[model samples]
Structure formats: C-alpha cells, structure tokens
Target: MRKHETYAQQPHIRIITGACPHDCPDTCAWQIAVDERTGRAVDIWGHPDHPITRGRLCGKVERYLDRVYHPERLTRPLKRVGPKGSGQFVPVSWDEAIADIAARLQQIIAEYGAEAVLPYSYAGTMGLLQGEGMASRFFNRMGASRLARTICATAGFEGLTYTLGAALATDTEAFAKARFILIWGSNTLTSNMHLWPFVQEARANGARVIVIDPARTRTARAADEWIAINPGTDGVLALAMMHVIIRDALYDADYVARATVGFDRLVARVRDWTPERAETITGVPAARIERLAHEYATTRPAAIRINYGLQRHAGGGMTVRTIACLPALVGAWRDEGGGLQLSTSGAFRFNRNVLERPDLLQGREPRTINMIRLGDALSLDPARLAQAHYRPRPVDPPVRPEEAGPPVKALIVYNSNPAAVAPHQQAVLEGLRREDLFTVVLEHFQTDTADYADYILPATTQAEHWDIVKPYGHYYLMLNRPAIAPLGESLPNSEIFRRLAQAMGYTEACFTQSDEEILREFVEAQTDPVFEGITWERLVRDGWARLNLPQPFVPFADGRFPTPSGKCELYSERMAEDGYDPLPTWTPPATRRNADAATVWQQGWLFCISPPAHSFLNTTFVNVERLRRREGEPSLWIHPDDAAARGIREGALVRVWNERGEVHLRAHLTEDIVHGTVLAPSIWWNKLSPDGRNINQVTPAEESDMGGGARFYDVLVRVEPLAVASEEPESTQQAVSLA
Candidate 1:
C-alpha cells in the first residue's frame, strides 16, 4: 500500500471541534479529522462529548466537508466588474480588497456620516465571539451604524423580561420530569430534530405531548393530540384557554393570591373569550380547546415549548404575552418540568457592558436605525426618511437622537444573507445598490446577497474554525477546536475581524484581546451563583458543562416571580406606562381585518411562507446540488379545494400575487396546509425565476405596533394559472402575476 494510504488507514486520527452556527435550535458540535502530511480533512462526525447534541450532527453540518471543499467556494477576494447583482466579478488580492473596503468606509464616514452605513446581520451564524459580539464591537468602535435588531426575538424578550425580570428558563434536561409538554407553533421534529430524542424520552416516561398549530406538521402528527387552529389566531386561543382555566378554578389560588398581581384585571379581560368565542377566531373546535385547556391545567407538571414562529404576525407580541401567562396561572413554575420553556441557552455568558467601555473607541458616534423598518428607511418616501431623521453624526455625537438612519456608509457582511432573508427583498436590494454605499460580503459561494456586493471575501466553514456554542433552546455549553486549516486563503470570522480591527488602527483593550482572552474574560464576567466554579479552560477540556442550580423546582415557587411587583405581572405596569394594554389580550392581526385582504386574496388567501429546513436558511444550503436536487424547484403549497377553485391542478404552473409583489411557482395541492392558508418555502429568486418567486416579495414589512416584531404572516394574496406560455414558459411550468 502507498505510504499516504497506509497513514490514512491508521486508527489514530486528529480531532477538530466546532459547532454549526445556523439559526437553529439544535446547535450541534462537530468533530473532524485531518491527514498529517497533506493537511486535508479526511473525516467528519458528531462530537460524542457534546451534552445537548450527544454525537448527532444534522444534514447541514454533516455536509460541511463538501461545502468547504466545493469547487465554487470563494478562494480569494473579488471586485465587482459589472453592475450590482449582475454576477460579474474580477479576482483581487487581499491587500487590494482591504484597501478598497477601508478607503470606501472612511470616505463614507467623512461624507454621509457613520449612520449612513448600516451593519445589518441576523442568526445566520450564532457564534457568540465571532458572530454578534465581535461584529458589533468592531462597528461600534468605528462609530459606524447601529442596526436596532427588533425584528425577530426582541418583542418576545421584552414581554418576557417585563414578566419574569430575567431571560432564563429551566434547563431542557428537566424535560424528563415533565408530566405534560405543550408544543406551540413549533415543529420540533423538523426544525429542532436534535431535541426530539429528549422529548421522546420524556414522552416514554409518561409525559403527554400536545401540539398547537394552524397546520398539521410532522411534530403534530407525532403528538398525542393536535389542535389545529386558524393562522394568526393563536392569541385568541390562548386567551380562551386562560378563560377556561380561570373560570373552572383550575389556577392555584394560593399562588394567584400571593405570586400574581394582575389576576383581577386579567380575569376581567379573559371572561369574554370563552371556548366558543375562541372557536370562531381559531378554527379549532370548542370542545377540543376546552379539553386541551383541561389537560394542561389538570396535569401537575406542564411545560410550554414556545417557538419563534408564533411571533411572526401583526399581533405577535400580544399572542406571545397571552401564551406566556398560562404557566404562571397554573402555578406550573412550582414543578421541576412545569414552566414556560422559551429558547434560552446558558452556553456562553454575555456582558453588554463590554460594548460600553470608553477605552474602545474614545468617542465615536453611531448612526442608529430600527432594523425591522429597513424598507422604509431605504425607501424614497421623504416623509419616512424625515421621520427616521437621516442626518450625519460622529460616532459618539453629543446629543443622542431617538432614531437615526443606518449610519454605515459601507458594510462588511459575514455569515448572513439579508437580501434573501430580510423582508421585502426588492427594498433590501435597492438599499445595497446605493452608489455611495460600499458593501463587502464574506461567503462560501456567490449568494443572492453576495451577487449585489462590490467586493466578495471568502469565509471558512465550521469544520475549519475553532468555536464554541450554546443552544438557544437548551442549557449546555460546548467548545469547538479547529480540525483543519482554512481551505486556500479562506480565514475564520475571528481572523477576519482581527485583521479589520488592526487595519482600522484599533489597539484598545477590546480589539487587542485575542479570541482565547475574550473567552476567558466572558467566563470570568459571569457572577451568577449557578456558574460559580466554571472556567473557560475547564469548559474547553470537558467539551461541555452544565450550570449548577439549587433545587430547580423552587425558582418560581412561593410567589417568587422576579418582577417589579415580586409577582407575575399579568397586568404589566410597564405596558400600561407605555400606553398599551397591561393584560394579555387578543387583537386580530391587522391583515385579516384589513380591507386589502379582500382585494389581495380575491381568488384564494395568501399563505404563510415558512421555509422548509431541507431547503432554506438565509439561502445557504438550498444552492447545494444534493439538497437542491432533492428539493427541486420551490413549490407553492395550497389546499386541494383552493387549487381546484382557481382551476389550478396539482403540479400546474401558477401565479401567487399580493399588493407587494408576485411570484410564480409549481402548485402542489395538499391538505398539509389549512384551507385558507398556502405554504411556500422562502428560496432564492434567481435560482427559481426572474419574476421574483422569493416569498418575501409578497410578505409585508409592517411591524406590530405593540412590540415591533415583523408582521410577516399578516399578508393577503391570490393564486391563478398563467394565461400564456411563450412569454412565460408553461413547459418550464412558470407562473407570473403582479399587483
């Protein structure tokens, strides 16, 4: 045998540790091997030592070897040679790329001010050090722009914080003790597959699994009972459930009298929302609603597995608030497994005070803007622009304004694709197209967002980086050590940020700290008695660590809710102070009651475009040949009745249009979705069609007036078959429609 082959076949192998940074619930830790001589990755597997993942890697991370070694992976920097989003570029040296980025950013700061350039990102990557914290510090030090990230989880956090004081949850390991598990608006089997095993274990140990959703998902199919409700009517169902629990005297009288302050007001509010009233709003039958309420209340240990999906509507905050109150009412917090379980990870501790350090930038002004309202901020509407107060300011300007436009005149996008991921793709594209705004993208391949960049920088895969992860849905900390060197010239996000900081002449304590030093600093900053003896080095060696808790069942017992009033504030004084309802109340989503719904969905109603896990995630895995071939072209899912009503047969080309925009996709008629709602996975427009089949084309950018969460599901649209084929190929099975 050849010497290399013999060496490769040896039992001994090197271990590379890293975690998948996608905005997923699993947060898997990966192990990779490298050939000693060639220094090439030979194998990839799940970390056996990982606490939450437990040696299980998802399809996405399992294919990281292929993704890193893919022929099309960006190996060097490239400069745009054609118009924005034209997919034309010329290779450039690292020096040239850095110089160009730095010069443009400096020019923008000098001219339009820092706020003109917005550094927008999301959970495309969730690495605590490299993803959000480091990026935010770098930009903040530069006095660039502050993107108010209130779109996704801010509303839920704000509401929960007001009620609970701190954003923490009883660890998922406590699931084994749960008597009843209520899965609400979440398909854990598909989205959070890693947690399914633990859930199953809990069920096997005599836990009743209940699913509450508008559609029957894989999770619902596996549940003991599936309560299918109407889209955007979750708030009403929750309120009605509260009414039933309160009316039947299911609540813990002692807990209510001692631990809760607003029971009287909440009781008055929910009195009108009977099971019958909820049945009218939500499609779930009155009997089923009552039964589910009874089961949840009667079960001694009940837990609600809340997902982020429920908050994707006009009244999303209110819905979340209503649901959050259920556990408190039943005094479920007294049990080990009976409490509200939102996505709270205790992996790495975060200290926001690090960002406020004066030594970092010494007085840099940052332009600030609300991230949820990006379309409006970038729009031509003079009134909206004025309202945002688009003005030039220094990094640390004297008078701190309430709202300013994105100060970043130039942006360095790493690990995110906002063009395809953000609401209203057209507006996001337009904002990037601003001639004065210089944009740089770090990516593995040319994505929808990268196609619009002036410069594209290569990035390393998870297997090629050293990192750590803590799941947002569970409480386990994991350490990741690099298995192999970055392919070609590709570097980890940390190296990239370090180089950028060096280039910008930032040498303060913040930028000077290495990744290891930062990790140590973060670990030391944690003062929570639960994490007393934990250290960064110990965490790295042990692979995983758990936060020590003293008698978990006693946290919310004895009327000890951590609120201003020392009780669960069902009637939030905070909300009332903000001129909003204090009680968890039901308000219909604006779109359903809007006059536009009738006009938009004249033929059939608009569908909620929840992207499938196999296909989308900021459009990263969708472009992969294997996954794409498996998924094929994106299909619009509609009920058989709706499809037949529009004279659109299954597999037929159809146009789905609303006021915002239109998209053409092959129609797949099924009962998987509700009667009035359609299901379309968010995919790349260029990959599917030129006429923007990207579902966000039709999704409105309206923020909930109550909590500023994205009103994504609050949309109305119609579906129809294309009349002609020559201009729009029927052979290709393409559909075309517009407002």
Candidate 2:
C-alpha cells in the first residue's frame, strides 16, 4: 500500500485513492481528501481517469463524508439491555463483547452442532476483503450451514448464462456509438447514474432511446419514448417481439445458422406468441409492439440495457433468457455497440478459492438454506426440517433426510439489513424476536436489523478499511486503501471476524491474515489473462485498472459463446436438465392480473412494485437525514382514477394491505404509473416509517423460477384512505380496470 503523505502546496491535506465499497454497480474509483492533522476525511470525489466514472459521483455518494463522520455512527460495541426490537443498549468493551459472543456460539455448537450456526450477509459492501474474505473462511471452517445468498441478481444472471453462455455483454463505453438503445426495466438515471452519460452521448449522436417499464421513472420521462407495460409481463413482450422478428424475416439468417443452436425450435415456439396475444397480457398495443420489433431488427448497432428489476418475478429468469435471445437473433453481436448488457461481472475472473478458501469445508456437505427464505429458515421447527422446502439452488446437493440438521441457533449478520429489505417482513421480525436465537450484528449505524441483535458490533466505514472492488457494470479492478484511522473503537469487518475466530480457539493461520495480506494473496494468485497487467504496485499507484482486453471488447462477436454447444443456446438443454423449460416461455406472477377475475379477488386489487428511491440505495443511506429529507416520507404512487375510486385523496394517509401484512403510507396520486398498479419508492427503515413498517410487509416469501431469488415485485395490495385519526383504515368498494 502507498504511504500517506501531505501535499507540498497544502501541508495538512493529503489525497488518498480508494474505491467505493457500496453495493452499487458503479464501483467508482474515488479519491478522499483527508486532513492529516485532524485525521478526518475532508471530501471525496470520483477519479478523473476512471472511464465509466468520468470524474463524477452519484448524489448518494457525493455526501459520503457525512455518513462516515455522522454523529449517529456506532463507535463502540453494545450489548442489548432491553427487548430484542427495543433500541436499548449499553456500551461494552471489544474484549467483553467478543468473549461473550464466542462463549454463546460454543454453547450452541455443543448443544446442537456446527451446522446450527448460520452466517447471514449480502452486498452491504462489495469488497473482496471486507465483505466476505475472513467471514467466509470462519463459517466454512466451523462447518456451518451454507447460505445461498440469492436476494438479488442470481435469477437474471442465470437467465443470461443459459442464453449467452456467460454474463458478458457489450462494453459500456460502446453505448456512445449505438444507434438504438432500449433501457428496459431500468431507471438508469438513478440506479446507474454513471452509464447515463454514455446514453446521453448516444442520444447526441442521433440515437433513439426507449424505456420499457410499468412506471414513468425519471429515466423513462427523459427517454425518446416510454412503453408502459404491466409488471412481471416483460417475458410476454419479448416473445411478441420475437414473433414479429421471425414472421417478417427480420432475423439475421446467416448469423442464426452459424452462431446459434435450436433456432428452428425457437421459431416454432414463438409462433403462438403473437403481438395481439401479448397486447392483452402486457398492456402494450400490438401496433406499438410490431413497430418496436421492426425498428430493433432493422437498426444497426442496436443495444439493450436491462437491470435486475425485471427478474424479481415468477418468470424473471426466463424473462431475461427470452430477452437475451434478441441480440443473437438479429446479429447484434457483430457490432461493438449492438449486443445486450445485463452484467459485465463474468468478465472478472477473480480466484475466490484464494480469497474465500472454500477448501476449509474439507468436503463437509452442509445443508444450504436460501437467504430469501430467512423467515422460514429461522422459525422452522427442527422436527419438520426434513419435510420443509428450503429451496436450495439447483446446483446444491439436496439435504438427505438423515442430514436435515438442527435448527439455526446462531445468526451472525453483516453487510445486509434483512428486516427492511427482505420479503415477508412480518415473519422475519417474528423470527428476530425469538429469545433463544443468538444474533450478532456488525454495522456502522443502528439499522432495523441491528435493533434485533443480541450484540451490536461497531464496523469500520469504507474510509477506514482496505478492500479490492470489482464492478458488475464495468470491467475495472480498483483497490481501496484506508484513508483514516478507525473511528473511536470501531474495527474493520475482517478484524472483527478474525478476533471472533481467535476467541473460539481456532488455530488456523487463515484467520490471522490481514486485509492487505488476503487481497495481495488473491491478486498474486490470479492466472487469468484478464489480470495480465493488474498488479498490487500498479493498483497502489494508479488506484484502478481496466481488464486486459481489446479496446472495443465485443465478447460475442465471433459467436464462440462459452456454452456446451460453443454457440448461443436458443434452446438450452442445460435448462432442461435443471427442470426448467428448454425453450423461452412466459409464466404469470403469483399475483394474478385482472383477466383472472376470481384470482385477482383472492389476491389484492393493485399490483405493487417497490423500486429503490432516487436518494437511497436500498436501506444504506436511509439513515442519512439529508438524503432521507430529499426522499421525503415513504409514500405510495397511485393513478388518479384508482385513488378517486378508493376514496383516497392526494397526501392522504392510506393503509396498503394484503394477506401477508400491511403498511401505512401517504398516498400521492399521479398518472405516471400504469392503471391498477401502484409504485412505492423504497426501502425505508421500519423505525423511520409512520407505521413502523415498510413495503416489504406485504411481499411474500416466494422464489423466482430458477435461482431461488426473492420475488419482491411479484406483490399485490389494496389501498384505502385512513378513515379516522387512530382507527384502523377501512376499505371502500371500487372497480378499476387492470387492462
């Protein structure tokens, strides 16, 4: 690592290069201006040399200094002195906390088994070192139950893999040269702000940009056209587009013949999915669908920018698979800017074996529990464990009847806030309230999840950690050097886990590996050609480096896809073996549309989608008062007609409910959303909400088609105005068209 030195011009100021460790796709290479005298971060800005960042940071990250040095930031370990959900805790020394936590874990292991311990985590920090390096080693060595972390991206990632062989895509920089762009199911301006500049560049070059979403988002409003389709109906629209493309002979015959498999089967499969059929299902006009298909097929250098939002439904995986087939069908891969881009994550070939050290498992086949089903996993009766469906991933070996394992006795949570973000909020809180459950949370602030912890460990902020970051949106490897000393008594996550392992009497050398040592070992162990020139010294001096590839990195231009057939699989035999349909197909969400009148009545009236609010990234920055103020209060966006029928006035406090649970929110009437649908810009912390709950209360613990991913958007709820100041909100008779 580079040594920190004061600038010659300003003796007290030093600039330190680091990477943003948040869960965002844009893993920006940033420089933190630190005052060496005071040992505090002065400001942070994006690195000018980073291609995708372009010397710009998003609104949420621009004020990250406030977050790191916030008054509410946890600076000492705490032991809960009150009830589980009560925000009451007394400060404890690091030695006392670690010793007590270790003693409890050992007692649980002795009473049950090692498999009773579960480590719950996800992308709070997308860093190789701080995120999971030491924690994974610790859990694996302890023979704990494996957590299939599938809250986000797994379904869409698997879908892209089945069709395109890997999660490779057209270079993000190539978007500037595209003639046509489809911003499908993505609010690019908010979630992927860095890529918006490239989109704007394309627009300046006379390119047409279309947004296909249920709500008129900030990105949709700025697009050349917006196609309002019903939620979870993206698959039907894709199939309808293929119907027009194949029927009109707009597909590239030569490319399909040479570079794709099962094209003939795909042709017959999409024949029945006509534009007229999709019109009724997707709420898109048949004429408009036909025009979109023609334009996409004929336009050269056409590109599609899809996000993970579309894959949060019953058919999310298949929906992505169907959409991925379009680029190859039209020979879009031949151009630098033509192919579809779901993720560039596959381009990174990090040697996780060195970082995570799964070899610590030593062939222990532990039961894998899906993270999205935490509600069931925590509350499940040990006697019924054999019968319960944990729904592990297809690749995981099923737990035998004899190896059903004991109930989860210990839960160590880091990196994620499940109480506010997970589906089936009520069940999760119920599980958290269990007095027997030993829970420890490592966090910077007292988040919703932290409020339920037996012990709250103070974790280091990004400015006080050493990490290596890889972006899913771009092909860059960046390193983060600690910009300042640990605040108060806080420690990096790596050190916290290391201390726990020591307290547990673990004598493994891996447990003692420093953050820099772990990162250095992983970087040095890399053998892939992509890491050709990326070295520790280079990263220390330059902060970031792009993968060693061709300038315009067109991954699939030659059609040598990394599939079993060595070509794009129009019909995936791998999918068939995995018990999924071999060809692309549409599956309706569990929440039925209005066409199914009886089912709609059984479910709620309106379809609900809770996308990330513009000012917040999931539940990360919600605690920041400035950002929270910018987001205003948690509210539901409903169409004017639907609100009027429900006797809901604008700014009226309304109760939204379904079978699972309910939440109260102020209603904002607007035509920006589709009819019979409501939008909730989430996710608000439970304690901060007016009703002590958020949108997740109504979301079910349902899994998507392929990857056991959370189906957060596959939700339904009914909204009505609050009748009295303190009484329960009453429903009103209303009729709204779902068509």
Candidate 3:
C-alpha cells in the first residue's frame, strides 16, 4: 500500500494507521488524520477494512484526542520537591533525570542488592513494544526483583488452562450463529463493545440471551432474561446446572464419553449439587436453575461469554473451571458459536522470549514479588514477606531474608496506576509515601501513582509512537505507526527504557536497536504457524493482519484438545497435585465465610463489588473532563431495601467501611442491585474523589485460589448515612441503574 495522502490527493492532510494501546480486548485498528503543516492530529477513526472493529470506535476512544491534547499532559521530567503524595514537582532536563536516576539505582543496588529494586506495571498499555519490550530487557539486565504481574485475569487464565489446555475460546465473530447465549459476569456493552454487535446479530436471529450476575448491568438489561445470583456463588450455580444436565439425561453422552475425562468421577461429585441445594447457596430459584440447565443442554449452538470479574474471589478459578466444563458435556464445540468464550489470547503466540530478552539475566534468579501484594512487597519487613512464586495460592508462613531476599528500596512504575487500582488502598498509599523508597514513574500525566514518584518522566501516547498490539478477544495483530510528532519533550516508553540502559553504562548492542528494528526481530522470532504470512513488512503495509486460522474456527470439534491427555480434562490431575479439588467444586468467598466479630460486628454488613465504571477503563480516562463529568462523583449503588434499612435515601452521602478502611460515596438506591449487596463502579483517583479514597479502601489484598490473582470482589462492608445533604436533586421518575 502507498501513502494514504497521495491516494486522497490531499497534500496538507496525511493519514496514518495505528492501534488503540489502552488495556482493552478489542484491539481496534485506527486511522489518524494529521495536518502536515502543524503536525497535529485533526481526526481519528477506526480502520474501515478491519473485520472486528468494523470502522467503529468505542465511546472512550472516539474522544481520545482530548487525552492526547489535554493541557495537563506531562511533557518533561520533573523532580518531586515536596512530601510524597503532595503532587509538588520542579522541571528537570532528560539528561539530568536519567543520570540522577541511574546513580540512585546503582547506590541502592550496591547497598541493598539488586533484588531490593522492584518494577511494577500492568496492562495500562497493551502495546507489545511500548509496554515491556525495552523495559523488560532493562530490568532483566539489572537483576531486579521480578514482578509476577498477576493483578488481573491470571486466575481465570489458569482455570482455562487446567480445563481446556490453554486460554482458548470460541471465535468472537461466530457468536452471531448461536441460538442461545449466556453472558455471565461480563458487561459486554461497556468493557467489550466490539463483540456486542455479534451478540446483537444473534439476538436478531431469535436467540435467547440470558445474563447471570448480581447486578443488572447494561448487558443484563439488554439480555432476554436476567437471573441475579449471589456474588462469588458462580461455582455453585455451575455445579447445580451440571447436576440438572446429568440427572435429567439432557447432556450429550456420546460427545462427553469421547471428548472428556473423569466423567464417572464428575457424576458422583455433582450428584449432591442439586438445584434445590444450590438455590440455598446461590440465592437463585431452583426452578430457574433447572430451566437454565435444560435450555442450555437442549439448545444446539449454545454460547457463553464469561469475563474475569467472576474470578476475582477465593473460588474464582474453580468457578471458571466448572463453567468451562459445561460446553464439553453439551457437545457445544461441535458447531460454530456453540462453545464458551473466556479468552482468545492463546491463539496469538508472539515471540516474547526474544522481545523481552530474559537472557540478559545471566543465570541470576531474583526474588519474585506478586503485583497484587505490592503494598506488602514494598512496606513489609524483608524476612516477613516470604518467598513469592507464581502459585495458585499465597505462600504460608514466613521465610528468612536469606530466602525471601531484601525489602524493595527502589521502585519503577509504568503503564499502571497502582495507588488507585491495587487493593488495600490505605496500605498502598502508605507504601508509596515512604521517604526511604526511591520511585520512578514514566507516564503521560501526573497520575495518582506518579505524584509519589522521585522522578516523573513523560511518556508518549499511542498517536506518537510505534508499537505492535495483540488482541486477547480477537485474532488480529495490529501495527501502530506514529501519526504525529511527540508532543513537547515526551518520548515513547521504549525509548525511555533504552536511554535508562545507556545511562547505567550497560554495554549491550540490543539496547541500541531502534523501535522498528526491535519490532522486526520480534516478528521474525515467531515460530507458530499462526504467523505463517503475518510478517512485520506486511503489517507495516496493511496496518493489521489476521492470524492464519481456519475461517469460522472450531478448535475442538474433533475431540482432540490441546491438553496433555489430548482431550478436555473434566478432572485435572495437575489440579489434584496442586492440592485443589480435581473435580469442579465451589469454594465460598474467604472474606464472607471467615467473617469474624471484629470485621462483621454490624448486622447490616453488605457484600460489596467494585467493577469498573462505563466511562473509565480502570484509572485511565478519569482525567478527561467529559468522561469524568459523565461518571459524576464516585457513588455507590444500593438496593432500596438495604438503603432504607439503614436510613440511607437516594443521593444521600454514605460511608462504606470495613476493617481495612472506609470510603465516602453518594448512595443511589435502586433495584438494579440485589438485596444485601452494594455495587460501586470505580477505580477513581484519590485526588479527584471527595474523601481522598475509592472502593479499593474496603477491598482486601487477598489472593484467590488460583494464579494468585487479586480478590477485588471478595469484600464485606457496612453502609450508613453520613448525615449530609444530597449533592444534587434526585428524580424518582428516572431509571436508577446504568441504563
């Protein structure tokens, strides 16, 4: 393909193709119209030729220009001049900042060992190059403490792997052919907007869409039927469904016998999980549960869309594992759009080994720290923190310093805002406020995490960088080209890490490689057949390319799964070896089951869940004035019965408190949420909120049963009116949910 401007016959306007770098599953291929004269982006739109995005941008990405051109965007390196969390800073040149940062890092390494330095990051930017290409090399060379990076969907990933062999799923585009769809624990309209179109097409074809969640989210309301269940009781519901399917002889017996293992053991395990028994545990009616199971088994081409929200609890992994077994029993994999969709990430086998360059470690194995335990990893005593590893559960008992290594004395933060998103907000804030901890943040703005940094280096946005993005929900690999010049003194995250490596006097030739050169090497290193014709040059020419997969791909149609047994593991021996139940079982939420008198002293304690808001993707887009105004102030959604029981009326200021901490939020009474449960759509920045806190204050830094993921939804709190007037007028006539 030639330059787009030449084809359009426009000399002043040049169009460049790029990919959305935010932490989203829909890696939309986008085009930016830049004014050549002023070097400014004039317009942006989705790639019309892309199959998944289909020339449509999400509500958030549609206004991405506001973020790139925001007046408060960081453009230079700054040194903190006041106490931590004060947001006080003075400008510094890049050379001075790099030299000072390198010196401090070296001193820390010499005094406290390289393991004392920690690098913390997450999927704030999903770009392969900008996210961790160069950063991983720098950290590996330094022998710094390794971050487990398990803050998000690791529990679900592990569950899928143990059950289905990998994080494989039904194709997103095939959802249109389904006759029955179950959108479980996912708000498709908000989080995964692109897949919603296929779901709607299925609906148009007379498919019945049922949603099973505690709150009536937008997707649920749009669904044909919304069946509310108790939070963290998904495993129980799934087991009961299996019970009904097996007991009623509705399952595909031939398919199950040939395609799955441990059928005999699974039968005995789910025998006692009757709908009546599960009704007591899940708060869903027995008849409805039985009907759901019947419909699911009887309906040919049934599809399920489960997200990571359900796996943010003690039983999260088991919940996903149990649900992943349903498709095999019903023989859903035999047809297109008939299986479950948890994640399609396993399909894109990128050459991360070459790109990240772990060989730079030189045989040194540094202490590992879990990102979910960032507060403890940073603030706890060295000997008390224990030896961290990538396990399904937290390490028990403490290990000595000789085993666990030293405390984190230096921190590097990029791509994520841990201060706002991490659980146990107070502890994270405390850790960030430590005077002895040296922190460096590379960001586009002074985020909640950046305010506590010893040095803040400006990072470029997606419009001004080169990157390759892989989608977790689809099968396309996108290439991002620079649409406009870097604003002010801002640079790409890859460049920043490259310069840091140079300042450290590291003599590695890989550190001098350009972004495009690194990208080409990354592309060439791919050995998977999925990359057959997907070359770096092709990506540069076409902007995006689909994986070389079969059209309407049905992966397990022949009963040949990718598991060790060559079939679906209904009962995983690996799980049994790891001290987990081999067959699917429900493990109640730890916080709820072990609520002591001290934590649950009051009778009005409500199960609280803090899902992301529609306008904000974690902490991103919160600084945008339009999105923030649309989100309004941080508010809690409560049932009218629960709110009235505590004298909490609509729009009244209320306090949601637990043993960890308390957060003040306005109460919006609605039937959208179930009784005895409160919903707070969040990840709001502390500085912008009314009480300098968010929902994470009440969320514990607890790990789930698998993949050591954060239990963000496993929280119990008491809600009470704060004796303040409503901030604005309330209208009883309006709908009370996120309609």
The sequence of per-residue lDDT tens digits that candidate 1 reaches over residues 1-739 is 4333444567665555667777787777766677677778877766666667777777666776777788788888889999987879999888888776777777776787766666767666677766666776777677766666665675566666667766666556677678899988888876777767767888999999988877778899998888777777888998889989999999988878878888989899999999998887687899988988899999978888877777777677677777888888998888888787666752235554553343454576554555655665665554454333322111222223334343445766777777776776666777778776678888888887788899988887766665566578766666666667788888766667667777766776677776677767777787776677778878777755666656453357666766788888888987777665788887567656543333434634554645454545547676667766766776788888877778888898877665566677788888878777787765564544546447777776656645456766666666788654223223211111211
TM-score of each: 0.90, 0.96, 0.95
lDDT string for model 2 (122-216, tens) is 99999987888889989988889888888988888889999988899888999998999999999999999888888899999999999999999
lDDT on C-alpha atoms for all candidate structures? 0.70, 0.88, 0.87
- Residue-level lDDT tens digits of model 3 in 1-739: 4334443577788888899988778889898888888999988888878888888888889889999999999999999999999999999999999999999999999998999999999898999988888999999999998888888898889888889998778899999999999999999998999999999999899899999999999999988999998889999999999999999998898899999999999999999999999987778999999999999999979999999999999879989999999999999999998999988899887769889999999999987788888777777665435634334553343456667777789999999999999988888898999999999999989999999999999999999999999888988889999998899999999999999999998889989999999999899999899999988889999999889999979878888888888889998888887778888998778755654322332544678898889999999999999999999999999999888878998999998876678899999999999877899998799889998889989887768888888899988777888874233224211111100
lDDT of 3: 0.87
- Model 1, residue 269: displacement in angstroms? 0.7
Error of 1 at 95 (Å): 1.0
Ranking by lDDT: 2, 3, 1
By summed lDDT, the worst window of 10 consecutive residues in model 3 runs over 730-739
Residue 520 lDDT in candidate 2:
85
* lDDT at 163, model 2: 92
